[model samples]
Target: MRERIVVTGAAGFIGSNLCKMLLQEGYSVVAIDNLLAGTLENLPEGVDFKKVDVCDSDFSRYVEGAIAVFHLAARNCLDDCAKNPVDTARINVMGTANVLQACVEYKVPHVIYSDTSAEYEGINMFPSKIDSVKPMSIYACSKRSGALMAEGFKNYYGLNISTVRYFNVYGPAQDWRRVIPPVMSAFTIKLLQGESPFIYGTGEKRRDFIHVDDINRFHLMLIREKLIQGGTYNLGSGEDYSILEIFEKIESEICSGIKPIFKPELSGEAFRTLADISETCKTGWTPQVTLEAGIKSFVAYTRERLRLG
Candidate 1:
């Protein structure tokens, strides 16, 4: 029998991609999602899917006989989280605890947690190191709460766990339908439609964007090689690009004449984000896609989806 891997947010953007890779590697994937923020269309074929929320008391049954449980389900919309901190806490904090409890109860050998770079929002250090976090937003706090809970499980139950803090991940099947979609997706979608996209702030905010393929590569490494256990690693490009620069890069390819409508800056967001991926790099992994190449692929995918040339 092949490895049975359970992914909590199997219908989500990154989660869907991870599931596809796992299937390609011949693993039997048991995917779970409540469909609140994920769609069934995103899941690959041959998956044992259950429309389940991670917060359920008996969610652990899905993890039975699994090699590892990849916990990717959470309320991740930053602005929405800011407006409804309680809802955010309920899903991201308590929900995470429920998943961890399930892992412990099931005696799963390994757990690969999908953490966020949002935890570093209040810290100004460039190329953010995985130390001394200062989360500014409610969403950031929720993610931190999950990490803390994971630590508790590690200490008490001796469960093997590894955390990957992602930095602005993007690629095909990106969530372009959110009220505030990722900048790259929003830009490509709007430009392909010949509409002016909105820029929330001055478009000067710098962000470290990593291609989802690059992230999946490391995910494969973690699962197959078991390179680093019980450690946290940053999944990023180790390079930063300003919002305006990213806009220019996308616009130059999709629709040259479109201009973005500028608006007041969003609250509870960091002005800049750059990941210090030195630890992850030590394992002989590096980002493989260049920004231009990545953007070109994004534009092509968006155009095809919208039936545009």
Candidate 2:
């Protein structure tokens, strides 16, 4: 019999991609999402889906008989988390606790948790490592709390839970509010209308942008290999590039006529973020796609989607 896996937030970008991979690998998938930050359109075809929030009381019952659980649901908006820390904690922190409790009760053998790079904040360290997390925002703090909760469950209940901290993941189905997608969207829209797109923060800040396909691939590799237990790994390209460089690459690739107008920095935005993927590399996985290639593919995807609609 194929192993049963439960993926929370299965309608979100990463979750949907993971679910598609799981189905392709011949695993039975139970995909549950509240459609709060995820949508039905994002989910892959021919999978079991439930429109239920992770924080709901019935969530525990859904975990019964599952072999493993992949918890990815969270309030991803940093600005919203800053505005309402209570809601952030309720969904990210408490909701994670609920999942952990269910995993324990259901006798699920393993739980893979998806953490974020936001947790590696305030430290002046370049290529931040997994062990050096100093959360600066409410979203980061909430996620860190969930990581600690996973650790706690491992210590007490001996539940095999591992975490993967994702860097700036950009590819198809990324939320438009995120940096890369918004920039691409703005540029594409302006190019058609003969206008210029704006850039924030002088474009000096650097980020370690990993292709979502690579991220999903590495995650599946981790699960199949079962390398780590109760530890965290960073999933990234182990390469960093300035925002200006990325913009120039995009402009050269897609929009050459329109110049970017610089704007003031956004509040609560990290100035620099790079991932140290030594741990992930130990798992025999490395990013196979280049930024330029991924961006081109993403642009084509969006363009085709628009044309179809």
Candidate 3:
């Protein structure tokens, strides 16, 4: 029998992509989602999918016999989380506790927790390392709380958990429906439609963008090698680009002749984010996708989607 792997938030961008990759690697996947943020169309075929919320009391049954679990479900939008901090805490903190409990109950061998680079919002340091974190926003705080919960599980229950903090991940199935979408999706979609995209702030906030494929490659390595137990890894390209630079790159590909409309800076966002992946590199898993190649493919993917619709 194929090894069983369960993924929460399976209908979302990263989860869906991970499911596709896991299926390709011959793992029996069980996908779970509440459909709050993710869509059915995003889910790939050939896996057992359950419409279940992470906070649901009965969510543990899905973990039975699974070799590993990827807990990705959370209230992650900055604005949304700011507006509904209570709900964010309920899902991010409490829901994570429930997932960890299930993992312990089921005796699952390992768990991969989906974390964010937003943990560094309050830190002014460049090339963020995993050693220090100071989360400022409600979303980041809640995720930090969840990370603390994971730490407790590792220390108390010996759950063998691996936490991955992602930096500006982008690719297909990217969430473009939020009130404020991701930068790549927002810029590409608007440009493709001949509409000018909005650039929050001065369009100079630097971010370390890593292609989703590179992230998934690291994930696969974690599963296959099981090299790190009770470890935290930073997944990024180790290169930083300003928002305007990204816009220019995308525009260079589409030749849209459209300029971005600058607006007030969004609150609770860092001025820059660059990852220090030295420890992760020691695991022999280096980022393979270049920003230029990644952006070109993303532009093509977005253009094709717009054309189809």
Name the runs in model 3 displaced over 4 angstroms: none
Model 3 weakest lDDT span, ten residues long: 222-231
> Candidate 1 on 1-309: residue-level lDDT in tens?
899999988899999999999999999999999998899989999999999999888888989999988999988988878889998998988998898888889899999889999999988878899986899888899999999989999999898889999999999888878898999998888887888889988999999999999998988888776657788999989999999999999998875698999989988778999999999999888999989999999888888888843
Residue lDDT tens for model 2, 50-147:
88888998789888888778999998877778888998999999999999999998889889999999988778888898877788899899999999
What ranges in model 1 sit over 4 Å off? none
lDDT by residue for model 3 (35-54), tens: 99999988998989999989
- lDDT for model 2 comes to 0.83
RMSD of 1: 1.4
- Which pairs of residues collide in candidate 2? none
Deviating ranges (above 4 Å) for candidate 2:
177-195
Candidate numbers, best lDDT first, in rank order? 3, 1, 2
